[model samples]
Target: MRKQQRIKKNEDFQQVFKHGTSFANRQFVVYIYPKKNQTELRLGLSVSKKLGNAVKRNEIKRYVRQAIFELQSELKANVDYVIIARAGATDLNFHETKKSLQHILRIAKCLPKVRNEVK
Candidate 1:
């Protein structure tokens, strides 16, 4: 993700946490807040030191970012999302992390609505 698209400020994460709705699972917690009139989605990631050492934390963050990048087109626009990693997240593989993240996002309604094909 680009710098502009990522929420890097402490205040931004707090704002989202203060005003956003969240959904939690065993591996992650997803917080979301919609920005009115905006056209792009912004993402923030949080993985605390208690979860692991720097290397492990960065790996988890990478997994989450990759999942977001893969699903970028399906994400809702003008929304700010904060994904908080729980302890169990460190033990998950890439596919498991992606699946857990998707489940969290789906519960939080951050992903775009699915459409059925008409053939």
Candidate 2:
């Protein structure tokens, strides 16, 4: 993800946590707030020390970043989203992480709606 597309400031994260709506799955908790008139999505990731030591936390963050980057085109634009990793997340491999992230995004309604192709 680009630096401009990341939510880096502490205040921005706090605002999302404070005012945004959230949804969760086994691996992730997602918070989202709409950004009116914007044309892109901004992402934030939080993997706490309590989830693991440095290596594990960093690994989780990397997995999440990769998943989001891959799915960026399918995500809804003009929104800020924060994804928080949970303890069970460490056991997941890349595919599992991607699946879990997709599940969470689906539950949060952050993904663009899918349409069935006509036969």
Candidate 3:
């Protein structure tokens, strides 16, 4: 994602957390907010050190990115997606984590019903 399009500003995160619509499931919390451009969807991943060491944190971030990539088509355009990983994420296996991600995405109504499971 381009830097300009990405939600890199701290204020943006705060706005999303404070006023934007949110949804949470087992794996991750999805925060969706409309943005200046509706032509693209940008993603943000938040994984804390409390979950584990740097390696584990990076692993979870990677999984989050992969899951989002797999569901790119299902994501609504012109929105910003902030995915916050909870402590439970570090312990879940890959497949289970994917399910958790899909759950939140569906809850956020970001996933298209026509699309099947993302492998």
lDDT of each: 0.90, 0.91, 0.79
- Residue 36 in model 3: shift from native, Å? 5.1
Q: Write the residue-wise lDDT of candidate 3 on 1-119 in tens digits.
A: 44554677888788888877989876678899887756888777788878889999999987877777777777787888888888779888677787888877777778855457688
lDDT of 2 at 42: 95
Kindly report which residue stretches of model 2 are placed more than 4 angstroms away from their true locations once superposed.
Answer: 112-119
Q: Give stretches of model 1 more than 4 Å off.
A: 112-119
Residue 29 lDDT (model 3) = 82
TM-scores of the models, in the order given: 0.91, 0.90, 0.83
Q: Which ten residues in a row have the lowest lDDT in candidate 2?
A: 106-115
User: What are the runs in model 3 whose C-alpha is more than 4 Å off?
Assistant: 1-5, 114-119
Q: After superposition, how far is residue 43 of candidate 3 from its true place, in Å?
A: 0.9
| Winner by TM-score between candidate 2 and candidate 1 | 1
lDDT of 1 at 117: 89
